[model samples]
Target chain A: AQSVTQLDSQVPVFEEAPVELRCNYSSSVSVYLFWYVQYPNQGLQLLLKYLSGSTLVKGINGFEAEFNKSQTSFHLRKPSVHISDTAEYFCAVSKGNTGFQKLVFGTGTRLLVSP
Target chain B: DAGITQSPRHKVTETGTPVTLRCHQTENHRYMYWYRQDPGHGLRLIHYSYGVKDTDKGEVSDGYSVSRSKTEDFLLTLESATSSQTSVYFCAINTAQGREETQYFGPGTRLLVL
Candidate 1:
């Protein structure tokens, strides 16, 4: 079984400021980690994913995340944010094997970017 | 959403009514999934289909049923709508590509159960 936990429920940051959204997971088997973003009244869009080999992965919109296996964490970060960056972010996990592609997601963190 | 379309983008219904939401995909992916999103709960899988006529339950499948008679269409049915079932419904598709189990989602259906 796999589960994801996003530490923050909401994060408010000024424009051009750096921000980080923390995520942690628990799984008995090797898993694939992903980050998705959802704008108001829309479905989730894949921001990035970590399958193997790379601990630091860069994603769209100048965002990036580091997969720390020792800490069981995959924290999303952006050096600078814009007002348009305000959205709900979700962290998800799935088994690394060839099993069913069932993704377990976190509760989500709402990012608020103000000018 | 990548070629995925969920019908009746928004719906309002009363209790005891039967509602079915349709999801269509032109990508011809082999896997389709139904998930409901709510505040503080993220997305919970309702049901999923691997192929036509092959459906299985998910974590939150008690009040939902799913059917897939054709490769391009997957339907999620609520036998009896309830206030507790009011949430944003999203449909997703997964291809058999590589070891990466990436899923593309639809625009979503906002279902308000009164």
Candidate 2:
């Protein structure tokens, strides 16, 4: 069984400021991690994913996340944010080895970028 | 961009009514999923289909049923609508290319149960 925890329900940051959204997961086996973003009144869009190899992965809209195995965390970050970047971010995990792709998602973190 | 579209983008109904949401895809992907999004709870899978006529329940499948008679179409039906079931329903398709697997979502259907 795998579960995801996103502690921050809402994060507020000024424009051009750096922001980080924390995500932690618990799993008995290796898993695949993913970050998705959803704008108002829209479905989720894939931001990035960590399957293997590099711990640091870059995604669209100048977003990146680091997969820290030791801490069981996959935190998303952006050096600078824009007002347009305000959206809801979700962290998900699925069993790596299992053929089935069932995603367990976190509650989500709402990012508010104000100028 | 996965050529997925959901029918009746928004709907409203009263309790005890039967509602069915349709998901149509042109990608011909083998896997399709139904998920509901609500305030604070994120998205919860209602059901999924690996292929035509092959469907399985997900974490929150108690009040919903799904059907897939053709590769391009997947339908999710609510037997009896309730206020608790009103939510934003999304349809997604899973595509696996070599070692890469991704799920593309549709615009979503907003259902308001009165």
Candidate 3:
């Protein structure tokens, strides 16, 4: 069975400071990794995704995630986060060839940005 | 911005009563999905539809049923609402334009069963 693990349930960071949300997955076959953000009272919005390409992938809002094959990790990072960046982050995984049939998700990490 | 909408953004129902949630998409995507979000479980799939009238169960489809009679609308129903079924439900569409399938979510519907 495939599963995703997000170690931290919540991460607090000072505004304008760098932030990193860690995610790891376990799967027998190749998989696609994705990061999503959900603001309060809103649905999830796609951050970035790793299909088949370079290990480093950049996304919206100056965010980036590095897909480490050997470590089985896809960590989301941002050089400087704003107050508006405060949201719950989720890590999801899907089977490589499956066309959105199943998308296993993590428990989610709440990013609290303080001024 | 896939133009997905879930009806009855908030609802309160009693146990043993039947409840149905509707998901409508303007994008006309081929694949639609229903998922529930709980405190510790994140988002778990309940059911999905591949096309009109082609539906299948998901990981957490024990007490839920779904129907898709058109490309734009997918409905999820609970035969008998339970307290455990009180959660936020989301609708998603598989809007894959390439090898990678990307899902766009709708503003969730919050259901509370007492």
Q: Compute the interface RMSD for each candidate structure.
A: 1.6, 1.9, 1.6
Displacement of the residue B15 alpha carbon in candidate 3, Å: 0.7
Local lDDT at A67 for model 3: 99
lDDT of 2 at A78: 100
Give the distance in Å from residue B41's predicted Cα in candidate 3 to where it truly belongs.
Answer: 0.7
lDDT of 3 by residue, B1-114 (tens): 999999999999999999999999987799999999999899999999999999999999999999999999999999999999999999999887666579889999999999
Worst 10 residues of 1 chain B by lDDT: B95-104
What docking tier does model 1 reach? medium
Give lDDT tens digits, candidate 3, residues A1-115.
8999999999999999999999999999998899999999999999999988799999999999999999999999999999999999999999853454588999999999999
TM-score to native of every candidate shown: 0.97, 0.98, 0.98
| Candidate 2 DockQ vs. native | 0.62
Error of 1 at A85 (Å): 0.4
Q: Model 1 clash pairs?
A: none
Off by over 4 Å in 2: A97-99
Q: lDDT tens string, model 2, B37-104? A: 98888899999998999999999999899999999999999999999999999999887768687887
> Superposing every Cα of model 2 onto the true structure, what RMSD results?
1.1
In the predicted model 2, the residue pairs found to clash are: none
Angstrom error at residue A102, model 1: 0.9
Q: What is the lDDT of residue B66 in candidate 2?
A: 96
Model 1: residues with Cα > 4 Å off, grouped in runs: A97-99, B96-99
